[model samples]
Target: MSIISLSSGVQNNLSIMPRWPATQVLIDSLAWQKLQAVQASLPGHLGLILTRAYEPRVSELGRARTAFRRAGICLFGLLYRHRKEEIQDIFGSNGHDLDGTHIDVSFSINGQRVRLLPLSVFTPMSWQARRIKKFDEELSMVLAALLAQGFQLHRNATESLQIHCDLKPVL
Candidate 1:
């Protein structure tokens, strides 16, 4: 199905989707997971749709980035937590075994911390991109999702002390 179809499905069902803050749209964890599960692979059109859905206006991203810098909150890239029990606990048993990894944000907001899992799936990690051959594909999808969500890469800020607010590099 198309990304707009997916977006419509998500938008029509607020109960199943994560709520965005009033002022800005934070990517929805469930919708993303559903996308990963339903779409075998992301083509350019789907990728563009995903980007448009979560990407803040350039001005909004700049403002949010500045505010985050002032607040001292850093935007580390996504972290994957594959613990099955933990996933079940947070999302409940949905009839599917739910073996997929949940991507966490590893960042803070307004002085509080939260995990944002961008990819949600029901397949086991072994069958997924963790395999050597599929690793690159998985990595590309994660980076795309992060970038679409407005996380910019900071090449020179590898040192923690040098970072004010930054996204961890893919390297």
Candidate 2:
């Protein structure tokens, strides 16, 4: 399989994004455990990336990087700063909801943007719900896997959380 990669600059931009305000519940704990399980189950040759709306806890990032490294899977993190104006621009004037969950980051590979929709917003079943708690890490892995499968970020749409991408077959 072709290896997927992001430019160093994009990665850096993600690293500096502001983290979301703390929640009363420890939602990330479950997601982190799930990520660890997924990492453990992935093929030896597969790589992993952990993306989030904001920068991750240093310990979490360290653990992910170390675990993936030992398994010979490349790992990285992507984060973005959340901006209310940007959300208004994209989701329209009355887009804010009582739920704090919102788009805080965008991932670009080779100058292309990847479309990301909340799995919950699109799917009906609660099981299909996109866990906003794990949005960052989940997005990271999805983007990484897509890149590994030979896709690149395409564009950011004017309105909506969707990010578009171009896919190319591995030579």
Candidate 3:
């Protein structure tokens, strides 16, 4: 079990509400950290970063399923929950509570939804256009996978969504 903490600046800045990019960096950093932790913990199998969705599709909704299958990683998705007690019950046999780790995001893509379980799962390591400037074959694969399924990334709802990751080690 690992402890996840948002920097005070990140926690407090949210009080005033910074711009999207600023908040994004914080989320990305935490996501990256958790990914690293999982990677280190489980040497061979790829770590699944599960997060919450409004009403997630048939698990691994986007092209991520095939991609994860090909890469040999598991992807889990679940509905969003706010309270710590409520979230505590959703854990897989693999892990628990995610140490209360959650990523709040405004779902950006249209006809698009990724079901990441354990309350929140992430696929954004590819979804962000800037990641190319910063990092994947990931985004393209996710998009292509979705396109193959006939889903388009048109602009849609602006509802604030939470992306959570369950640090459950899975093979």
Candidate 4:
């Protein structure tokens, strides 16, 4: 399935991207565990989706890089956690396990931050409602981070970030 097929709202929100250096993160295992714990502690569908539908924490990020390439956006992937080879070997085994991004540092090149693709590219197709909600949370966090860093992203009604943007090297 394609990014556009995930959610209409995602498309609307990501249609316009703010000009900023796109940074994709590889969330540590602890973060995943923490999210899992949080879900477990909850008492309803929120916890159910997180506990049931969530994919295993990934190590190698080749698939994410591929998504970034497919979106044609320049994103710097950051990983803070080191895992076992077995875990890395299983990376990208499940397509639903996309969106391991977490912002670590924000920097600009030549005093100008480049434009980022829409946040939707990181999200994967899923039928669960709560899972989709989590994707929105990730996307919002990215948008908020960009805005906080003095970048501006607005929706482009005539174009989509996934099909239109070309990533430039941040260097």
Best candidate (score: lDDT) = 2
> Please, what are the lDDT tens digits per residue for candidate 4 over residues 34-100?
3334333433322111111112234344445445443443221222122222222222222224432
Model 3: per-residue Cα lDDT at residue 99: 27
The root-mean-square deviation over C-alpha atoms between each candidate and the true structure, in angstroms, is 16.2, 18.0, 16.8, 18.3
| Deviating ranges (above 4 Å) for candidate 4 | 1-27, 48-71, 74-171
Candidate 1 lDDT over 75-162, as tens digits, reads: 2212234342333232322211121121222222232322222232333345443432434453345445555544443232111111
RMSD, candidate 4, Å: 18.3
lDDT by residue (1-62, candidate 2, tens digit) is: 11222222323123212222322111133232333343454444332333331222354643
* lDDT-sorted candidate list, best first: 2, 1, 3, 4
User: What C-alpha lDDT do the candidate models reach, one value each?
Assistant: 0.30, 0.33, 0.28, 0.28
- TM for every model, in the order presented, reads 0.23, 0.23, 0.21, 0.22
Candidate 3 per-residue lDDT over residues 34-146, each given as its tens digit? 43443344323222222321111233332343343333222223322222233222222111112222332221122233332212223242333343333234334433433
Superposed model 1: Cα runs more than 4 Å off: 1-46, 49-85, 88-120, 130-132, 135-145, 148-171
lDDT of 2 at 68: 38
Give lDDT for model 4.
0.28
Cα deviation in Å at residue 134, candidate 4? 14
